[model samples]
Target: MRRMRVAAAMSVAALALAGCGSSTESTPGAGGASSSAKALKIGMAYDVGGRGDQSFNDAAAAGLDKAKKDLGVETKEATAVNGEPESAREERLQQLIDAGYKDVVAVGFAYAPSVKKVAAANPDAKISLIDSTDATGPNIVNLTFAEQQGSFLVGAAAALKSKTANIGFIGGVNTDLIKKFEAGYTAGAKAVKPAIKIQVKYLTQPPDFSGFGDPAKGKTAAEGMYQQGADVIYAAAGGSGGGLFTAATAAKKMAIGVDSDQALTAPPAARPYVITSMLKKVDVATFDFIKSLTEGKFVAGTKIYDLKANGVGYSTTGGQMDDIKAKLDAYKQQIIDGKIVVPAKP
Candidate 1:
């Protein structure tokens, strides 16, 4: 039954990815029963990639669903349209708050400023923002992940799986958040294979966040790495990772995914090309936050998810990862035990 459910979910995700179906919106009261006497009201605003990137935004949506079921929250969502600027996110956020949603959650670092602004104006409201710590309002809860630990595991996997000594990294932007993934990945690869060669590329330079959602440019960047003899490419570029996956599939190389279990996100043509994924448990974080709010234990401060708490790690699904499961499990244990320290910056 578990396997069947996984299959069904994968099928739905594939349909959504193919544009044949719409993104799934969580229905209020979907979660079994509310543990609290009062019904919770939750709102989520997605980053530029909207909800179908099969990565961060999707994982956040999953958490909202769990919240709706477990806490009887009435949920609402606002997705960023394609080509929308960071400034536009503010409008969407304010719209949700104006509609009377008390617990608003923003799913990307880009939403930090908007969340800060909105949370301040609505002090009585509770707000949560993931992948960012910039919002310091008393009404806001900032959720961050120790992404370095997860990237370390996958970086090691990339090194072990590479037929060539060269590995590549493609990021959405050069911000500290994305750098955390690159730095950790590089360090992990070097730790496992001392002589490994790394090629790093960013989709955007300073002041440009649009690159995170541009898959075409990501594909172009990845093609250059493939030409330079990189056998494995790890992408932390949100929707842009789709292009990296496309390039990897065409080149018959390996691609490491981010945020969620991306083995399930890859197109059929690129499925076999994915080596593994660096996972940040965004869904768990979302559900946990909503649970806290429902229990009246919501705190306004920075909350971190790290390896010791199973908040971040690598994938354990199908394909090449299956063959390396034992070794990966051992590495994960070592990291959790403090025997390994992954770098957070490059």
Candidate 2:
């Protein structure tokens, strides 16, 4: 499984290079009209936890909401269950296309196979893929991110704030993509304090991706880390992050969130313990894709959103990050200028 994920990640990188990092290459539009001329009917296929995950999926939801309000696009949505198969994803997408929703947006790397298969079957449809590069075609736009860069910032935050000089990392799954989070976080923490003790855990292995949705697993993993002396924990586990926040509250420790500002979006009780979040900016990517399609400028290729593009960063909500904001920004600049190269694997 590890080897497969590594190969997949490498494939994405190779494809990005081959595509020349086409950030805004406009292809012939699907409908060839401005948004005002005709309202676009878009279908969103959300990853596990759907719109209320308060982390990854919620960020995607925000983009969909903004597009609906600002561009006047009509939209429908479908959510994936905890243990659904690839065939299910393929069917969900096909259903949307068959229903006349010509522009479809899929919310995770898990949807790549389905996107590719469905895009091939429906040549007239435009499909936007988020967080993956495995799928390719003239009608598909891949929206990916430099997730490790953002994770590095929050990892630094964890190390800086750790009272015990020990931190923890919880990944939703043991995939190469999530490994980027672990790699950046570990690198950042070690850079700040070489002797700091860092513990890592993943909720599930591949082929059982319920880790992204299982709060129980998150809580269990976090509690164990806290028991082992970790004072701060970073979780890249989609909905499972809520469990980490819960564990933080119970243990009187701190937890870092991913993909969205969990300090603001998490439940009120969990807010106080959420020091920061690695903002992945799925919202920006999603909104941009819809806007491009609506404006008759749909593009097919990988668009990598990184720290330089303001597509990924650390959130300072709740004012807990106020003291270290300048330092984080400086590190951000160094990364943007190529002084620091964050690893995509651990």
Candidate 3:
């Protein structure tokens, strides 16, 4: 299993290099924009928690920061406010556009409509909308991730470590996007133990994305799962993931984090409970998108970050997952080898 994993991981690395080889030859920015601009001006419109959420938003911020450092790019940032009307989203994105930001990246799927509208209004602007699969426009680049592929790895790890043969999943919001996490996790857990008990819960539903930020609600939901016999839980709830970490610590259980490496970023008290994180490689996507734009290789279509491309994987930090690396790697190889097709829906 370990050998299979190493070989599979190597394949992804090689493919990643080949995959990015021609990104420079992609379609020019809208209006056949030139890369001779005075400076690389980039803009970021973050989700509710913005850069400090220690989850999804933070991952995006990492990429933007890398761009600023490596490319010496000038940047503008916009924050999301809960329950705000769609007009507010449009205004936030438009503010950056009007501010002369040549490349603007919207950080969440909720910005789909606004991105579509804004990108259309500014046909010459370079727009990258994350987590969006559709929304056609001249310069609109949809950035999506193979979240299910990564989620399955973490689920298998949880199953391997669970003496109770029970695990849990907590999603921030009930949407097609979050469902993908649940589906992949359940499949992976079952694959490992065949009869592993999986508990699932959602923090909130659409039109109410507050679940991503409500740590209290997250703690309560995770506590319920833990009480019901789940020894480990996977959290895909953005900032709310912090609450799951807290619950894991208090219950003396384990929690799998998402997006960034939570073992390094979670609060000191909760960090110990974080066995591993499903790395979504948002920073890579963000930096690559900006890099493409600056180099005039900006493509105006969907770019998928999937396991085969090393865009998603499970973190092996802190050595907590070392004991099960072979098992986890086997599953990873299977997914990359097309032996396992992780579902994007529940």
TM-score of each: 0.83, 0.86, 0.87
On the 0 to 100 scale, the lDDT of residue 185 in model 2 is 96
How big is the positional error of residue 118 in model 2, measured in Å on the Cα after superposition? 2.0
lDDT of 1 by residue, 1-346 (tens): 9999999999999877876433334443475344554677787888766677677888998889888777688778888876677678888888888876778888888788888888888888888889889888788888999999889889989988888889999998889889999999998889879999999999997577767778899999999999999999999988889999999989998899999888887898898888788989999999998899878898899988998888998876676787877887888888888888777889
Candidate with maximal TM-score: 3
> Residue 29 of candidate 1: its Cα lDDT?
46
State the lDDT of candidate 3 residue by residue for 2-92, as single tens digits.
9999999999999998888767556444444344567788989997889888888889999999998888787889898877889999999
| Tens-digit lDDT string for candidate 2 (2-54) | 99999999999999887875643555355444556468899999987788877
How much does candidate 3 score in TM-score? 0.87
Q: Which portions of model 1 show Cα errors greater than 4 Å?
A: 1-38, 80-91
- Candidate 1 residue pairs that clash: 31-69
Task: Please tell me which predicted candidate would have the highest lDDT against the true structure.
Answer: 2
Residue 9 error, candidate 2, Å: 59
Better of 1 and 2 by TM-score: 2
Task: Report the poorest 10 consecutive residues by lDDT, candidate 3.
Answer: 27-36
The stretch of ten residues in a row with the least summed lDDT in candidate 2 is: 24-33
- Per-candidate alpha-carbon RMSD to the true structure: 11.7, 14.8, 17.4
